[model samples]
Target: MSRGAQVGVATVYRRFPIKEALLTEAFAEERDRTLQLLLDLVRRAQEAGALRRDFVLEDVGLALMANAGIRAQSPEVRAEASRRFAA
Candidate 1:
């Protein structure tokens, strides 16, 4: 649950209708962590003069498509990934 504490299904389902909703909620923290890792890597590369200054959003998107787990997901997932990366 959002409280980060374990609770029974009766309590959880009282809030969420389906299991996927709960999964998506739980996945949010993980997604944030993954986004932070990717962003840190990109920022470090830029700071270290390894990433080109002219690199644009498309380049970042390609990198995510190549290296991120989002390659297999749908457009909505890609949009979420883009939003996460942009954050």
Candidate 2:
């Protein structure tokens, strides 16, 4: 997770119309890029026998949701949680 995730998520949840429109496009493009990158990494892992060939994109979504569930009392704490989560 990124350090700015707390702020970003808060912004998303607030749903300001103008900001939402811009953020929507920005996040959509970023999501596409991230998805592709993940797909590539998964493919590489499969080729290296680190992951099963049957692994699919839906599994990635589940993993991401699990990661996003992390929370903490402070930004610093949350950042630490994210780092540990990535590890």
- In terms of lDDT, which candidate is strongest? 2
Model 1 collision count: 0
Instruction: Put down candidate 2 lDDT per residue, 36-56, tens digits, no spaces.
Output: 998999999999999889989
* TM-score, every prediction: 0.55, 0.49
Q: Model 1 — which ten-residue stretch has the worst lDDT?
A: 64-73
Model 1 lDDT tens row, 48-69 = 9988767654576676565565
> For model 1, what is the alpha-carbon lDDT of residue 9?
61
Clashing pairs in 1: none
Candidate 1 lDDT score at position 84: 74
Note each model's CA RMSD in angstroms. Answer: 10.4, 11.6
